[model samples]
Target: MMLYIIDSIRTNNFHGEQMMGKIRTLWENASRKLEHHQNNVYGVYNDYESDYRGDYSLSIAMEENNGEAFIEITSSEKYKVFQVDKTDEQGMFKTWSKIWKQEEIGLLERAYTYDFEKYGPNGEIEIHIGAV
Candidate 1:
């Protein structure tokens, strides 16, 4: 299924610890602003270039009509989804790390265009990794 999103680039070139910091900051700011929309918040990883050092754009977006005003409206292709229950306070980074590990173990090849997180009104979340 296609997802319509409104997004912004929260970083340029960053990796390792620096990248993690940027991700955290981006989420913190975005999450606060998105609180008004409740469960409509979504995060996207957009890579413009092929290399690891290339530009990495992290965006926190909301689906159309989900509430917050947006800068860009974009659409995503089909994805291979992984659902995780936020039963504990394990945090988003660890959850994402687990998802990436799954990706590494032949879950699916990343499409590299974009990958997104879908937040439920409840405590659950779905990581929608774009797949070829």
Candidate 2:
């Protein structure tokens, strides 16, 4: 089974923080109704045209690894890669494992966060939140 996934990224610093916070608020607001159990994928990518808030567009995948979640970020750019895995007891379901790692300037960081959704069967909707 494949799930529709929406991915997002956040940068460090005040401006990035503000954008991240706003993105989180948007997710929480919609999550109340968007929550599902059909299993969906999640990932992030740099929007070369993201000058405006809507410039960053989220992607939806219909075919992918089952219960697998992937997340990646490209250097010098906002490109990110992610996969969602719900079958493993330690991937998405486990918060610790779901978290990715990052290190910059000799400091450890979790560059981005990934999550999954399974909203009813055949549920199709446009991704509204996620920007970096």
Best by lDDT: 1
**Residue ranges of candidate 2 with Cα displaced over 4 Å:** 1-14, 48-132
lDDT of 1 by residue, 10-92 (tens): 45444545766776677777666666665456777775576324576666776555434443424546677777657757656
Q: Positional deviation of 85 in candidate 2, in angstroms?
A: 14
Best by TM-score: 1
lDDT against the true structure, each candidate: 0.63, 0.36
lDDT of 1 at 82: 76
Query: Candidate 1 clashing pairs?
Result: none
Cα error, candidate 2, residue 17 (Å): 6.3
Residue lDDT tens for model 2, 1-108: 333333334443234547657666646644553455354433333342432222343333333442244334223333222333445554432422233222223223
lDDT for position 23 in model 1: 67
lDDT of 2 at 59: 34
